[model samples]
Target chain A: MGGLQAGSVGAFKGRDVISILDFTRSDLEELFEAADWFRRRLLDGNVPKLLDGRLVALAFFEPSTRTRLSFEAAAKRLGGETIGFTSEEAISVAKGESFADTIRMLDAYADIIVVRHKYEGAALYAAEVAEKPVVNAGDGRQHHPTQAMIDLYTVKLLFGSPDGLVYAVLGDLRYSRAAISFLYGLTLYKPKRVYLVSPPQLRIREEVEMVLRERGLPYREASDITEVIEEVDVLYVVRIQRERFPDPMEYEKVRGSYRVTPELVKKGKPTLRILHPLPKVDEIDPRVDSMPQAAYFFQASLGVPLRMALLTMILGVYAG
Target chain B: MGPVPDSELLVRKIREGTVIDHIPAGRALAVLRILGITGREGFRVAVVMNVESRKLGRKDIVKVEGRLLKPHEVDVIALIAPTATINIVKDYKVVEKRRVKIPRLVEGVLKCKNPTCITRKKGEYIRSRFRLVSEKPVILQCVYCGTLLHEDEILAQVLGEQE
Candidate 1:
């Protein structure tokens, strides 16, 4: 929290939130502080008009509900207007318009752009071609920086600090952008250790392992989720999407391999909390939702203030 | 191999071209592949692989007798053969000599290995872009996908021919 007090808002003005690796420990702390400020203001029934005339463009070439709507709501609550499309069907892209041209056209209309694309590097490509700042909502299996930010904020709020905590990321490690982003965000804090639990076919990607090695952070990979459930402080879960597999039989083999049942939750540490970047199909049992350790809904709600803080910082309009 | 001979003796002097020397043995072909230097007509190319060297225990040298390499081509060579040196020969004398250094940014030369990477999509005109992250391990991260690629992947995914 000391880093938050020492940060200046001008540092992030006009910056592109392309990847979590682009941020440092202090940058994340500063964002969390800003989010806390916004949250308090909302509780007091005051909507800050810091971005009264700004325009945010949401260009989602992929389907999304939580990330797209949260970002739109964040911009609107900040007293800014928004204009953009939710799907490729709603845009000129269906007519064979190039990605660069779409970004260029959006750049001319909006102050900032938020993009989510099915292609891995689409957001970075858009950021390269556009004049306006681009925020990557979710880009293929690569990154979702804002989702990472909200996740970090959620964990920090729950534990009072993210330091000295053990995190276990379970299921679909290779294809989950949220898991990658969350791991990158966790590197900012001095965590106890990170355990990657998944089927070997869906184990953590080498790119993420390289980051952990470079940071000198201790991590272990295990095929069984139950092996680390009792030891870790947080269990970050991601869905195993059948669409990501080339063969339907391959997806069927691992479909229910890592489900978090009430029985499994009972064996976890009393202080353990569970989280998922949701729209989940059947990864978590419905019975676990009523438990005190279920934090996915709260985690989803944190997106509003976290994204508002991000927009405010990137736009350089946050007064406090 | 009784005694190591000078590289100049292995490949004849080039009047006006480029000499890629000090390449690790067995990697001359990879360097050629990366530079897109096929054994095509209208170019005099000499490739001496597994040659003895004092600096490198065993090395390869490629002497092109008619043309100097472009700067970007030199960068590609550096990625493949970090120890290789580029020598521009003019009028049968080495005029310019320098070791290859990895460029900060590489564009259109290599494709991202991720199948879902936008640069690989059929209709999209996205060029493959990578930022050189580590030279020793020859690591490059795709600017778009954020996927880290190593030397093996680089060799495999690099565009076969300029388009």
Candidate 2:
């Protein structure tokens, strides 16, 4: 309440959540405060049905667990209904239905759309086709705006704010849309430093790197996580996706190159928070889950309230 | 005139078409492409490449016989050849001449090389739109995907058909 505009109604009403870059530091700060408000409400067992009588279409052309379900849960928790498909076979897309036509169909039914697809610009395309706002759950290996929102919100909850936190983004920097989006989100705030930890072949994409350089964001590239492990306040890890690799041999080469273990966490600061966009494969050690430094489960839990805030704000129902 | 330059002699003067002068050397073919003159448009096109210029060390020139250049075509020419001057030929005389200026937004002229760009979708028919980000190296960002296209990529897209 002290941070953002006071009592401004529907600042983000019907706006498309296509890219993390679309929001400024101030916008995100306002959103975090809203998320905190929702968190408190949920904790008090007083859920506000801000999105009552609303419809959300979940158009997931690619396979997903967290993103799809979290958006669905977010809508329902706000007294909103969810529609749309999880796979192509569940819809007309399997029958050679065009992406535009399918989106148009959803637009007629839903008040808003949350899209996840294997193609990079699919969500942007959907936003173009639909009159309703489109939220990008994940798109190709480039963008996952809402996941970045939850990640940043978690960091804010744990460490006061994401500002001035030395972060080491570990694992797949090139092929993970969640990782890419998180990096983009960091540019909205002032970070002390960001250490990009990835294998040589999986370094951050050239365009993403260019954006960081343009923003004058201080960052360093390290092939191994241990290089900056001791210095970072946060170690954000992501799975090295085999499905993203165009070449099977290339995937084999980088497979298991980076893994977060209890031993690795020991190298970091005592107060270090480890985060991952879940449904991870072998990249993280299960034994490390019980460690005090592990914040991924808590991070995942924050997704619900964060998304609930997002839904209400997008629908112009966030009176706060 | 001080013994007409050999480059000028290469292509005879056109009676009722536009003459594009000072295209960057070796890019006359690309200029022709942006104009959609594929040598099959039934218009006689004379391309002169590696022509010596005092301003530009070397240049290419494209002369199309009987068609006036469109504004969009001029916009694209500015992208590849910023210093280019367009001369309108009418009744066997130069009627109008102007230097090309790069437009801020280019739409439906060049295909975005980003295969995943919304404009590149098979059945969407979304017109490719690009914003001019940098002028020196000629960088363009796809309005849909935010993918950057450097000079090489921009050239390749301009040369491809405008489908």
TM-score of chain A of each: 0.95, 0.96
lDDT of 2 by residue, A1-320 (tens): 01123454555667889889888887888888899898898899888888889999999999989888888888998899999889988888888889989999999999988998887788887887888888888888878999999999999989998999999999888888899899999998889999999999999888788888998888999888887899999999999888888889999998999889899899889999999999888999999999999999999999888999899988878876
lDDT tens readout by residue for model 2, B10-107: 87888899999988898888887677779998998899999899889999998988999866667678877888999989988999898897788988
**Candidate 2: clashing pairs of residues:** none
Docking class of 1: medium
Q: After aligning candidate 2 to the native by TM-score, how far in Å is the CA of A80 from where it should be?
A: 1.0
Q: Write the per-residue lDDT of candidate 1 for residues A198-287, one digit (tens) a residue.
A: 998898778778787888767788988887788989999999967667789999888988899998899998889999988787999999
Best by TM-score: 2
Candidate 2: stretches off by over 4 Å: A1-10, B1-17, B24-26, B38-59, B65-67, B78-83, B89-96, B156-163
Worst 10 residues of 2 chain A by lDDT: A1-10
Pairs of residues at least 3 apart in sequence or in different chains that clash in candidate 1: A121-B144
Best candidate (score: lDDT):
2
